[model samples]
Target: MPTVKPRLSKQHQRWVMPTLVALVSGILMGLTVAPVEAWFLAWIALAPLWVLVLFPTQRLKLLIPLVWGIGYHGVALAWITGVHPMMWMGVPWLASIAIALFCWIAITLWGAVLVTTWAVCMTVFSRGVGTFTRVLIGVALWCGLESLWSLGPLYWSSLSYTQSPHNLVILHLGQISGSLAVTGAIVAVNGLLAEAWIRYQGSGIGNRGLGKSYKAAMRLFASSCLLFVALHLVGFGLYSRPLVQPPQAALKVGIIQGNIPNTIKLYPEGLRRAIAGYTEGYITLADRGVDAVLTPEGALPFMWSEALRTPLYSAVQQKGVTAWIGAFGEQGQSYTNSMFTLTGDGEFSRYDKVKLVPIGEYIPFEQILGGLIHRLSPLEAKQVPGSPDQVFDTPFGRAIAAICYSSAFPEQLRYQANQGGQFILSAANNAHYNPSMPAQHHAQDTMRAIESDRWAVRATNTGYSGIVDPHGKTLWISGLNTYELHAETIYRRTTQTLYVRWGDWLTPLLLGLAVVFKLTSIQASQK
Candidate 1:
């Protein structure tokens, strides 16, 4: 019989094992997004990792969180490594993996300091305080940390808000508080469970204060659960009720998914293919009696201005449906990412893309980057910024469009919606990464619809082309990689939502409350 591999000594397993586990898990997570795994939601699954760190000797306790953090970061940001090669050269996938693992390990070590502080404070405070106060304070701290993360370079895409396979009801809260609010709840639960495990483990009803801790925790959790239900139920109820009636009646829209490979998208033949694909898609929609058909960003390979005026517009005019495709136009001084709209009657209107992709679209500080910028990226000319965020006029209605990552920022979309964007149109090319990314990244836009109380029309290249309603529900979807024309009827709203005016009000308020709470705690401790 073959001998079994000997178990590693405790000293070796202490650091290497945890880091390896984290690294492997992170890579595994990067492979796909299907069968959405709530990577860090459950108390049962995560508690042991904390215990491994907590129950260890004082010297090792420091390292415990370190290892845990490596795993957390690795798995969380694993997918980002897939696109690293596209952005930077001489940077191997291993380098990205190593960098991601180390960065996460370092961040977790820092985050562990805050979490340890909370654990200590909880132990101290829980001696006399009720679980209600502890949960509230813990929730606040978690929100504060998440807010700090939002300001940093590495955004936590896997925070509690992004927890996949979670109850749809929990996701509904995003409309009221944005993604951060759900994160706050998740972090608080994690802390609460951790404290409870330390204090009242294995104790039934026999323990004296155990009953009190249980009651306080129950009340606090119940209150939070109720809040989530209220927000979700109210928002979902609106969706189930009669559909919204926009200022204008329903506008027939045709969404074209031209599955262009990354390499060819920038090539001459690729541009030719893109133009042909869009023109053909628009023609199909026009034949179907639709009013307008949409195409993804950078739709036309070359200058479509002359084409829109001549043969393109003339062909589209008779089809009875307008064509809204992303293309470029020259305004004498600079180039713009403009949307070319040819009405059925051949009336044309142009709208430039407002929010540019930071590095890909326009290098922020051109003077600073200098000639090295050209060397850094192979693109001939980094796209210049568009002058103004404009509205596209059509016989159907006024619609505003965001090019790509711009939609991820809800405030921008809300502004456009408020600026007479009866419907929000977002165009993106997700062909840059593996297919799953565009699907998930596009999912984030559903909140834009809910928060703004307007219908969102999301059209993307290579995947996740669909329509979302004001309540953040998917009405229709055309999954990635198919030669087909997809369409959806989404009702837009005339009246705007509360989130449109204020824009992420809960996050700032929560952050302010955290500051105040921390200040008060410091003062009380000093006293």
Candidate 2:
């Protein structure tokens, strides 16, 4: 019989095919998941990417992670283009796409490196261990990523957040190790499946060992899932019990999503509508018996200052509630992105956003690039940054307020709880982020809730306006492509988790270890 031609053969097959497979699998993974059903398929989706990473070839190994990362981030985050122009209008449409794509590339490269690192480390450790221990250690290795370095900016797009809609039980476990706990399980499952496949395709000489390993891994995975489900059942029991206590002391909160188009946020006409939409939404929430209503970041078209407090304070007082609104606080030629709180009696406090978006909020290399870069690019020269480490006091309790991007960084949330913040409040404008981003963004709140053991209220303009519990479970979420209101219960959690007390100290230590290991390995190879 004639020799059969291999579908993927030689060097081209080794690198190109694996990368293509990884990318395709990544797309499938994204498609398989949604805001609510993220947890179930989290492991399955990553299996292909993990499989590519497991391949032993040097070139295929390098390209596999990079390509997989491209597909993973590119497909998952393509939704940012909708709102980029609002932040910076000078950049042409194509330039905005380029920037978004470029950012995705950076994210992808980082993800690939992380994934490759994980794969390499797992293989190195799995040499002679039983399958279950291997999986357990692998999971630890994966979860250990969250504790390694300031890693949130690189890999916080968690599988649990994607699964929040369908599996409330699964999401609740985040109370233990934060969301990264479940994320680690998901990655380990993917690792288990991918490694099993390789064993199946390999020679029979390793059959007994392979069978034992696969069997052990499956057992561990099954137990893990069952345990996760059991934990959810326990959370449900707690949730079903009397949660809205002191019913008479309820505070009405109105969260506004102005739905203002980004292109016009800075324009005079656009600013008028922006104010109208926010004020109108504020009116609606106020009339609904809200003791305090919140508008999304930069809700007002104009600058936020002690001067604008005149009308805003009067209106808030008239409404018989507090107004927590996002706007620009101007001083001289400088501007600050801020969230201002106005009480029913004209009392005021403001939390300016501290974790500013590096390029989006201000130019990083202005001295080197000169002002010409501003005209060439969409970014503004400087948007005043706020010292938002403090908590804002209200009639209820001390609430930690984190503006849009600030919420993504866990340290800010940890600091809030450490400083006696009884509750966490996040105001965002999803007009720039995709539905996926909101899903991921909202999920991060659960981790913060778990760490601090506090209730989180997330209100956004565009989509995913909702509330989360101390365990990282969502109470309610607003619908997309339309205006909606959600009345979710929230309470203060006096207790805190281990992560909260230590903050990100563990993350840096782990990252340092990984770097040292990589360096040592390089030295050994040279010898």
Candidate 3:
């Protein structure tokens, strides 16, 4: 005999298809997000998972979905690994790697849990339901889970963002119901494909039923294709509507990108560079007759008190134009990551950053893990969070201020928009990670701009400073790791998009309908 090969056991054989489907689906979904931007893949990325749900043979359904979650989040959030080699934080080489890996793994697992929960709900609650009912349940479950996760400690990489800044038509759907509406459309299309796949497979079974089943499957496939086009049509209609501009002077805002390395951002040399770079950019923009200027988050990298004594502060005072500069603000005994505005009239106002990063900003479960790791954040002290209901009142207009991580939360920004925020000022420091993080962060800002129907001005450290119009169009964008200054005229509109007024209303409605559908299906089965 040439060779003796062992065949896979029945149990292993059963798991083979599910495992492959789960991984393929997850990875494709991940690639649909930013940096890769294979948005077209998202339409069919979830179809395999839905098919697996409709015809599950694996003993552990949750295991497959959990693996799917891991695959998706691992790829989408791979930028989190860029935090490694944090020797600049005084962490030992191996310890720094360990911390970065820990953060990446922990968050990936958490995100995976959401996917697993949705899969389990669909498998359990959608049994014996018709194809249409099952799809309704699937869409509801997915949107509901997205909404729930958004309210939690970490929220990024929503399904809605898959279309952002690329598929302007689908992205426009966000104006109606935030990201949930876009997500619902995506899930609905995937579910229809899965239903068609199931019917096609059934067509191969009995000879007598073959033609009818095949025709039905073909009809469903065509219907799905039509529905996809119809959704795009609706989105285009929404996108075509012109935004009502307020009858006021356009505010010309300048953004300064100080390309400072995160490793040395706190060092004496780094601080000197920060001051010089921003001061130079600020003065240049001021000379250009810009109404206001915005600096990236932590552009000063020092306390507000210390910043006031710096040359940058002196430059802003002399320029006599409002400057929104990012620095640390004092709060009782702790400090706050804040955006401080130096008004033209020499008055000062500050908007402290809420939604601090869990371990990176402040160690969570400090009573347990405090002593285990020396420090993950480069900051010398733990920072206090600001109130969520804050807005920046500037000479130009009242603007929503989202400092770095806060940009990921849509409802938070929507509430600020409802509170009379005319535009969005997004300040970020992306020096810690690679260009992917900045790109993703910029995408989030774009979504916020569309949902609130407000122009968004983004200033970032070490790259991707730009301006976006109300319709998710980038007016101007800077290159990564560049020291640049850009000024663009953006309007301040008082009209709020429907999303701003409703604020995630679709999520609750979907969840409630899912419950009713599930109960009705169960009752019908019993009868």
Best by the TM-score measure:
3
- lDDT by residue (tens digit), candidate 1, 1-527: 23333344564566566545434433333322323554334322344443343332334444444454444544444444344443344435665455444434544445445444544443343333344455565566556555665444234353443543233455555555666555665555555554555444434567645576565545544554565456557646645655557546676678998877665676777767776777778777777776678887766645566556544556676676777777777666567776777666564777776666443456546787444333334344445555445666666567766776666555556667677777878787776555546766665666566656677787787777778776566778777766558776665566665656655566567556655665666677678
Instruction: Encode model 3's per-residue lDDT on 460-496: one tens digit a residue.
Output: 9988889998889998999998889998888888887
Residue 344's lDDT within candidate 1 is 66
Query: What TM-score number comes out for model 2?
Result: 0.79
How close is every model to the real structure, measured as TM-score? Answer: 0.74, 0.79, 0.96
Pairs of colliding residues, candidate 3 = none
Clashing pairs in 1: 22-71, 26-75
Using TM-score as the yardstick, the better of models 1 and 3 is 3
Ranking by TM-score: 3, 2, 1
lDDT preference between candidates 2 and 3, better one: 3
Error in Å for residue 356 of model 1: 4.2
